[model samples]
Target: MLAAAPTNALPRWKGFNVLDFFNPDPKHRRQHTTQEHFRWMADWGFDFVRVPMAYPYYVRFDRSRPIMPHEVYQIDEQQVQHVVDLVEHANRCGLHVCLNLHRAPGFCINAGFEEPYNLWKDPEAMEAFVFHWAYWSKLFRAKTRDQISFDLLNEPCLREDMNDQFSQRSAVPKERYRSLIVKGCETIRASDPGHLVIADGNNIGNEVIDNILDLDVGQSCRGYAPGLVSHYKAPWVFEHPEHLPEVTWPSVENGQVHDKAWLREQFAPWIALVEQGGGVHCGECGAWKETPHHVALAWMDDMFSVLTEHDIGFSLWEFDGTFGILNSERKDVAYEDWYGQKLDRKMLDLLTKFV
Candidate 1:
């Protein structure tokens, strides 16, 4: 059984990240996560939905050129309303909604479009980033914490190429990262004082944030550690995705022993946060389809077991794409047809066991 957090800890929310509007390119934006997806999740004993958004996907901007700093303030009600609609639908289906800026005003984890300014170095970008939180907070002011929350940003890090694995990547100096998070939380409360806010862990969600606990905000972690197991053959993440060695569990490879013990070791920092009055959740986690099915499942089991033992909840990276349980397109699994989509039953069963 999963243990409970301290009295002040955030609710242990278990669900998947819904990619309703995640793409940066307006033309290639994914279809809105269906209403049936929400209902299915509720019926399957899940109670959380994370909507990761690309700012460009919901704003009015020139498609022919990159968005300017001033353009960040251009509010497109028609496009933005889609988020409101999905949040309400998910809430009605008994799921708490966490809205995240996967691709924010001036920074993105992936190499989608060129940002006009650096979020960490430019004052203009920082203000624009906070403005977004303020806008979203006021838009849903009437909704309580039980129905809504805001994840300030997606995995954050400082890298030369941002997307390339070979780039010079480093933590966003903790002092700077802390200030940004504090400002974001403050901005949201200025509009909706009773709202709940969560900040992804620094350094691409791999580590814990000890600085923000006193602010009454939860901290989110990731499950994509030992990238060989989670992101194998992922083009954007690995320089040579095609040459990634075959994954294995209970085996020492890449100078790292990837077994249950290593899984627990990775989670130690987040566990310390809980002891100090903070809540932890795995914000984005899953292996790409190219990974051998059985190896991926084994890694997921150990990771989930450690999270459960530590009293943490998680949101899978996505609901219906390459990393999802539905239509994952992995050749090895014997899929179960669930309402026309190929469902990975083993993955679902594993998730259910931990939940």
Candidate 2:
């Protein structure tokens, strides 16, 4: 019989996402991650790493003009082994890994990339989704919950259609998204019931906390509170101005004051889920590189203040790029060259202090 799960079976997941793993460039993908990266994270006082990997990398796709679901898409065992090796590496370094599907079979937040069918509405897509998770369960069957956990999907939201326009307030009903989650969780449990599964909140992991409470799974909330501040001037952000003026920490925007109180209120739904014993995590949150250093830190302080108060852990959007503490090229902040990479000392200290 399986031992009872501890009350705190969920770790306070403070860490980073190896962004390089998400639809990486073919030529340099191999150079993106190494055992040293996990060691670096562990040494930096982080105990976890949430890997947002793309599913397309593991499945074979047809080169035909329009990709069809019926076309043979095989899971490459070799790719599976590569992920397994990464998990083992993370374990050796004393950091638990959260394996996530950033780009699943039939849906994704990205444009230009085609997933053909809708993940929530299409039967074929749902089948492929379950197949992916079931295979992962079998692959990591020997792994215990403490060593690794499953983040079934990444930033799932209500999509307008298969073409990638989505929003927090999606036309797709919450019940439909919840049902799809139930199916995915069931598939994972069928293969490996011992492992805990985490379902990303709807709307880029920002909303719909109550919807997944019935499932035997944890919930992940996005930390990009007040998107204007966190994603300032980011090209990908909707309606991003070609040139944005510097934004203040508590400045008023969109007719609402931006402050700590507001930040806390935004987390109300996730807090409610946590109160109901529905283990909640701040899965992804960070400011863009172009944002001024002082402004970003102040905004992050308020965000972390609320997270710390709630005893919730978070994984910063990344580890070594635009949003990461190390190698983050914020022009306004002075950085130290640590091991040939730019390290923002103050930023790193602030993140660690919160933990």
Candidate 3:
């Protein structure tokens, strides 16, 4: 069974996204925020920040190699130290940090990347993937268990159209994925026995609870909860015109309850898995620009309630940009725009309950 944190240990919770750290300026490379970001998060009543990192960023990605890139698997010590420094900074600011492998050496489930992992066929790629985790485990062995955690992959989807080794046809049976997860867990535990390992759900946070329960990987499992409520208005997502009078939280009408109950229902299986020795962290969940201001607030209110009720840790999708809490453009919409209006002190106050 997974052990629980002690009572005095920073509540094992609360925080938002730390997106800029990994996706930093190409020139700046790994250089990210110091005290300011942590202090700001602390001030906002957040106790943690999920830092999504790409493996290729730390290692050189050479396009001139053979099958896979030649330098694709090597980890640079200097780059690794930069990440270590960020963790230490986070600790100093009293923030829990989750080192997320957002983009692995060969794959990103996000579709924006050119090559995604197809572990079933590529032996070299699989070795690199496992080796990367092993390397990280060795590097971060010194940090306090609760002070940091590791998210295995951002989203390992089992989609049919991706045409990768992990697709429906050539996919490692669900049992094999469990074994890989165990191997990854064992690798980390061998070095840093106490650090938490968060395993992403399959189908991009849509499935895997069933697999997790059935396979029985010996650790607490967690996953990204997604931003369906907030993404109803995202341009990338197509909504049928026939399905108009779009359904949203806070309701399109006044009295009806927006689909909060259904959203919670979707989490039922994962909640059950958590009940059975696994822990849950809703790694990604947020409202996007498409959601109306009042509706977004209402959605957050409901979402927060459910998360708190279930005692799940969550991180908003981002800090700045489209679905961001802080808009990068610094527009004065916080008080004016409907969406902006919902993102003020009042919303922060509500979020404080969990943080």
Best by TM-score: 1
RMSD per candidate (Å) reads: 2.2, 4.2, 5.8
Best by lDDT: 1
In the predicted model 1, the residue pairs found to clash are none
Model 3 spans with C-alpha error above 4 angstroms: 1-12, 21-31, 63-67, 160-172, 208-228, 239-247, 250-258, 328-332, 335-346
Ranking by lDDT: 1, 2, 3
Backbone clashes under 3 angstroms, per model: 0, 0, 1
Worst 10 residues of 1 by lDDT: 3-12
lDDT of 3 by residue, 312-337 (tens): 66777665545556552323345324
lDDT on C-alpha atoms for all candidate structures: 0.85, 0.77, 0.62
List candidate 2 segments past 4 Å from native: 1-9, 24-31, 62-66, 70-72, 164-171
Model 3 steric clash pairs = 107-116
Better of 1 and 2 by TM-score: 1
Q: Mind giving the per-residue lDDT tens digits that candidate 2 earns over 120-207?
A: 7778888888888888887888888878888988877666555544333353467877787788788878877887898888777877
Q: Order the candidates by TM-score, highest first.
A: 1, 2, 3
